[model samples]
Target: MHDPAAPDPNDRDYPALMAPGARDLDALDARLVDCRACPRLVEWREEVGRVRRAAFRDETYWARPVPGFGPADAPLAVIGLAPAAHGGNRTGRLFTGDPTSDFLFAALHAAGLAALPHSRSRDDGQRLYGTRLVSPVHCVPPDNRPSPAERDNCRPWMARELDLLGPALRAAVVLGGFGWQALMPVLTAAGYAVPRPRPVFGHGAHTRIEGPDGPLDLIGCYHPSPRNTSTKRLTPAMATEVFRHAARLAGAGR
Candidate 1:
């Protein structure tokens, strides 16, 4: 099992695969492709790729790490669950070209947070103004839901994203009950304590705490999945209100 003179067979040369002159997003995409840190995730992602390949060969699924949804220098971060089978995994943009994205983008537009009203593709005439979206899990799971272990395994990437944004970030809006539950630790680790008022995680709850770089505010909404909205668990208005708070935190709200 141990050979001192030979290069290890399992060792991968990560630098070789990186895109030439790639700085942030390109490098991030490359790193996401070979992510094997989580054994089970890697296995599952591979399986999805095998079967879904025929379903979306021309659509061009990400088939790798789903990159963050906004600017590298954004001040607001939106955290959510993994890619949907036909959403992010298919279109390569977080919440882009999907049913939920239409509702989410409409709200962002109404809140004066995003530059575009319709988000159909990465190069579409839509963009987040001072915001970004990063999921707890980067890959598309079989179901929309991720296992607890899977959620925990992906926390480091979220933390790393926060770290990357550093001083530019002032707040994060967690989308979904599960999203809020998963983000508590990351916020705490970043020195963002509960606000004096102890902001609740409802449609319009806004909380601000001092982070190492600057103030870190937060808003929460249940995810905009069809099931959530169709079943009246998360209404479009509720999600819009949360985004409005995020806009205020980012200094772009009405």
Candidate 2:
């Protein structure tokens, strides 16, 4: 059983130095749950846990900040905007226990990034290969939206994750404009040197940012939210293609 309450050896403060190097991602992840930087996010995440949706009423909610999932040496990273209020906030894993995860993980499995096609819960035997899933905002925000201030407040954690994942990270797949926007500064701060004008976000968009570890391709894909997927704005084929792009960029076989 994956006990979320287990004390981790990797719990530590964010180092002031932002140079590229191998870092203890596990420690960083352990420290993430203790964060209370954004009061509104903290309050809302807990409330949602206390009063869960009827479907998940019998389950315990992981109201604390969610951490990234995958190996520290993963060559690819997928960044989402935030945790779904009822999804990640309920299951304690990014994109888990939600329709969006079904869409996203299906694509990832097709692209050979995930061991399974579905992400139902943290202990559901799901696994990743050469890829990690992270979000700029760890907490579940109200209406699935986190204010700009909240995003900024959470920047350090994102920066730290990127820095820790820096050594092997070769590319990233960003879902939605919000993720693209949020990742720019963190990438730059982590020594990725994002372009001066910033790359525009669009479906199938691809850009390369220079990093200390190596050049990383930033591939943009529309989020697989209910609204986008239901409307066919982002179909499985389209999502799969984007994940394939990320794999190719990371030199992962299809």
Candidate 3:
């Protein structure tokens, strides 16, 4: 588990930090209506909306915020970095309707970590059976890099989501170094201990977490972002192996 004394994840005063963000709230919806917190993302999305207009003008771009996806409650929590600006930023579902999702869900399917392999978009109607995708930053961060402030603004909601699914959260797959760093603090706060052996984040790093309710295992992987797999930093077969362990921790498969 991580200590509360660890440096605050975000730079804001704790209470003034932004509210919870589960992709299913009225207040969150309103604040996100015109959020200028990150100027870069706002500019990019607006540019996308403008240049990509024509037939796409009237279509709701989900430009506001992309919330967490997957079963609200599930056996595993897979955390990624911020939503890719053009990817989830356009679709409103994390890890959905993108190239990254194609590779990711395929591995999860083959490994039996997910119920299905196709995640075209939120309305594609595909659903996860026992797995969920929760990003530390609920919305897309510009350049795929969330400032410390934006990440901090979003942690409370991540914590809130963990509270909702923690009981069933037998395992977690943190994709990429940033996502892995984001999870450490909350895991510690929940009485989950970072492994003494210092489980390093990699394609298949594994550690144990002692939660308030019980113990859960932690796994790390390179983010399924095309930036990684396309560069060979992460491979589909390797990703499958990581999920295989996560599934086993959840008692889902052999």
Model 2 reaches what TM-score against the true structure? Answer: 0.90
Candidates, ranked, lDDT:
2, 3, 1
Q: Note the Cα lDDT for every prediction shown.
A: 0.70, 0.84, 0.71
Q: Which residue window of length 10 is worst by lDDT in model 2?
A: 11-20
lDDT of 3 at 211: 77
lDDT tens digits, residues 166-212, model 1?
A: 78888788887777778777777767765544455675566667777
Estimated TM-score per prediction? 0.80, 0.90, 0.80
Best-performing candidate as measured by lDDT:
2
Question: Per-residue CA lDDT of candidate 2, range 1-254, in tens?
Answer: 33456432222222222212325877777667766667788789999999989988999999988989998888899999889988888888999989999999999999999999999999999999999898899899988889998887777777878777767889899999999999998877667788879999999999988888779899999999999999999999999999988898897533
Better of 1 and 2 by TM-score: 2
Q: Which ten-residue region of model 3 has the weakest summed lDDT?
A: 7-16
Between candidates 2 and 3, the one scoring higher on lDDT is 2
Per-candidate alpha-carbon RMSD to the true structure: 5.2, 4.7, 6.7
Clashes of each: 0, 1, 6
Flag clash pairs in model 1.
none
Off by over 4 Å in 2: 1-23
Model 3 steric clash total: 6
Off by over 4 Å in 3: 1-43, 53-59, 195-199
**Which clashing pairs does model 2 show?**
10-27
